[model samples]
Target: MRIPVLAAVLATAASLCSAVPANAAAVWEPCDPAPLQCTSVAVPLDHARPHGAQVSLRVSRLPAGRPADRRGTLVLIPSGPGNTGVARPVTLNLPPEVRDVYDVVSFDPRGLGGSTLASCELSLADLGGLNPWPAPDGGISANVATARRVAAACAGNGGDLVRSISSRTEVDDLDRIRAALGERRISYWGISYGAYVGAAYATRYPGRTDRVVLDSLGDPDPDRLARGWLANTAVGAEDRFADFARWAVAQGMAPDAAAARELFLSAAARLDRSPREWVTGNTLREALRGLNTDAGLPRLGQLVRVASGGPLPAPPQPPPAAALQNLAAVATATICNDVAWPRPVEDYRRGVADNRARYPLTAGMPANITPCAFWPYPPHQPIRITDRGPSNVLLVQNLRDQATPYAGALRMREALGRRAVLVSVDAGGHGSYRSSGNACGDAAVTRYLLTGTRPATDVLCR
Candidate 1:
């Protein structure tokens, strides 16, 4: 999710290998031909009933370059509730300072990749056709039926993997991984949904955490959870779009910021009515949501320009059904398990209409019905991030994050109380650490993780 500068600490660090028990052997073998060492740790399906049943989690580790100076294992919690973490070592480009002092570790959660299989078996066509954005007129009758069908598919096919998946279970799995590695305490670098998991772990086992970095945090509302995250997408998009508009204006896409917004809105509305080309209203909204920085502004502007009233492109090919089925299976399980969503058809209709009116940029996706509405089971109580933990947390957030906005992060910041020191970067994008390219923000995170030097109060990195 987010990175560097402690040669002195590396040279003076004590070997933590002695803390591990001789009998607690974690046999880590290279994952294929990659540099990552892979292993599996067994944990109970349900933490409440530890003696009932068990499941094995696939864990991967990027060993510290200087094993003699390795202080502890640094766990990288992947972004999605559905995203695979075992492949994280390949994607994660850590600074030498961080890689030298800590063995980077990550794992796939219960229902994702190598660990376990849970397929919803949804039709490829249905998955592609199912847009969270309802009809332009805000009619949700078809959307409601689609939501019901998807949920039914998941209920029938997801099986025990869906039933056992929850934030609580995952956190417990993380602790088990720590024990398996023979580390008394572990450090964390969690982004987006991963940040929520990290907060849950820190609150539950504050004493067992050495240093925690909650990057691009989500709202930790006890009742809302992912729902809150979904709902905030509209606000985040609007905030981020302003930055994009400025970039577009500079790139000569529009005369002004207002013109850029107007062009995008009008073009999106036109596509909603008569969609002749490959680009549709949903496509535009998704592009807006996904454009995390200025680098994406020109392409987004071009897409909007061509889709407004220009020539059509070739018809796009539909993705394979198996892939969507896997993603839906895990994502639905996670969202449905984290919290309960509104169940009635009217609730969705009203939400879509209201959201569409209030935030035209996001259309109605944020408030529209998901598989959670028809989930067979109720959610386990969502965990609340509290000040009951150690003050070992460092939060690095961008002011205008599309996925996790500054406002939502403020709630997490407030919830953590004195346990965290926030490094607020004056930027407009998502994931504020190394990826932001803001030296001030990156340096703060690297310094905290490497040297354990955090500001006594929150610092604004501009």
Candidate 2:
């Protein structure tokens, strides 16, 4: 039975003395006075200390057009550990069948958008000045100092709430949202980092999970977690770069794929030795990331052509300080909180050495050190993903995703075992479902979401 609003308030008052009512029926109001509705969800700051403090998550809903066909709500989890979800439905590519039967819901994770906010209070210089990519020479001497200082800044300004932003913490928050909605079970559609969150939620609360879909799956290695994700990018980028090289040759930008690859590598090295316009080592890496997709390849080709020979182009404008600060704070907090990275400087040094030798295209950036190595607070142990939960998961992956490659997703697929059915799309890029151009992959996901059907065996979308 739904608790009365007054009873909900009294229950919350008894527990946390917070004004937020416990599991109160959401008082939905028009977000734009259109069809979209919005509300705030109150959850504990620390699930371990439920009565201590609280935070509010901004939640939005696009109610199903055909109520008669509506089966349940489908929550869309955004990609970045720092990406806000509350505004995602506006741009999400939802199939008509799925949209007709589900109220699409999303929320801004803690420390983001309308939620209880925290910032690292970092300077714009520090935000843009620091590069996640290590030196092209593979010397991480400067990176060590920067990682330490950045970690310290986050800890100093982020407060306790930042320390608690993690996949496990987010699972608790998800459950709280489910409870607040008065739903017995909730469907989930999570992409990239959100896939890890969805997996953790299913592992922790399998009974409450329904029609779960994990797109662009991340490595589920508990000990390594984000460390593995960062390192795997070297291989992922090399695989995706081949596609771009082929595209460049076909577009007449280069004589052939091999020549194109060599030219790109030379350009990266030249930029590293003497910065030209916006073509610094960091920007080169960022440009390659964009080059992984069809939609982005044309722009990448233009950049490459100019870089080969031309006047130095102007540096692109950096993001506003506030946006950068928020992103740095949230991304740093989430990864650092999930698990500790190896603290020894020599470990990263050795790893970078190996990566540079093995994957020159990536230039060892994937194995480089990050602020997580210097995070002050001890992190919770990561959840070991296994085939112990309900068999209700659908994994959609691209063959060559730059951020979450096929190799890493294979581990996730193996770990899920009988618990999931995977649709391996023969495509290149980070995401698969609606983003991948393959009709087979899109149809598979849409069919699964609409009818709860799974192939008897894993299928490759060709």
Candidate 3:
């Protein structure tokens, strides 16, 4: 899975079963799931150069809560084709059905948590400024320079570890992880970008998979891969914005169906010249950039309200330093490693111009060039997303997700063909299994995970 970088961007439980003895000091460990143990698994730094070197991946397992007779290993592949979430074993509180029947497993991919790390050493400012959201007039100058700087930084600091972070390598490592755990067939629960990692694994190691649940999918088209993922933000943004708009109107923007868009833009334009003083040099547009983030879901109309004829919403405080950097690094590496981006600054300029003209709501953030454009290395292998896997896949999507839009999810649905079933949540948010808004959608996914039973046809939970 790729770390969601602005661009950096579940649960359940049951178990009175005496708390399993926990790993001490645990800082995080290399562990194997089942036999209900934790241990380290090592993979070559560069697989092709086997004896060259190696890195440890943290792995862990939480056993099933049901019939003592084990079913299969169910790995909760964490997001970020690059965040070391190997600690998931200790973090998640899953349903008893999940714990008792299958060994719930997950690992920090090679070179990730508990494993070695590759850092760009980006300063906090650079991290905050990576996802160039153009100026109100849609400027791209600063964004372009930042992109190159980031690319160069990665090239300089990434080291040998960067070379091994590919989707294929990850699948291979997963296989090795499964082997080390002594499981022949494993099941998967992948959310967001985890869906990509899971799909790649199933495609490469079909016989090794039993049941799979992919949530918030991106288009599997390789060439257009992350670009597709990036662009979907516009769709996602628009979808949520519309929701916000409707809510705004409902809140008396006008005649039930408010058309107070002019007011919002007027406020933005007003702030463009005289930005509100939430912080130094950061204006309303810049503040809105925070809203453009993953958690800045569309329902923010509650915050986007106009005051004194100005749409000056109170901005939230920025996140912590370490939290921001690690997340940012993971997203940048995953995106950069996965594919090469458009290089011609002119291409990005034109793309941004076009996108701004077409989808002013996203302000050209999606179409604008990223560090991927100047990535130091090309993708290890061409992206290949075939519908050749088994038919045991289940996809659950929300009609409107701020990060992975419904349209992209549809493309994934098409890519999988008969190999998958889709469940659409009738809500507007990114968290699919349970957004706290769609119980039906949540129940459907939970059912599939617990019983391996899926709907005959794609169903919309309204």
| RMSD after Cα superposition, model 3 | 7.5
Comparison by TM-score, 1 against 2, better one: 2
TM-score of predicted structure 3: 0.83
Ranking by TM-score: 2, 1, 3
Per TM-score, the best of the predicted structures is 2
Whole-model lDDT, candidate 1? 0.80
Model 3: lowest-lDDT 10 consecutive positions: 4-13
| Model 3 Cα lDDT, one tens digit per residue, 313-382 | 5566665665555456657777777777777889988888989778655667789888888887877674
lDDT per residue for candidate 2 within 22-119, as digits (tens), equals 37777677884256788888888788887766777778888887999899989998678888888776678888778889988988888777666657
TM-score of model 1 (CA atoms): 0.91
Better of 1 and 3 by lDDT: 1
Q: Which stretches of candidate 3 lie over 4 Å from their true place?
A: 1-37, 67-69, 87-93, 253-260, 279-299, 306-320
Give the least accurate 10-residue stretch of model 1, judged by summed lDDT.
Answer: 1-10
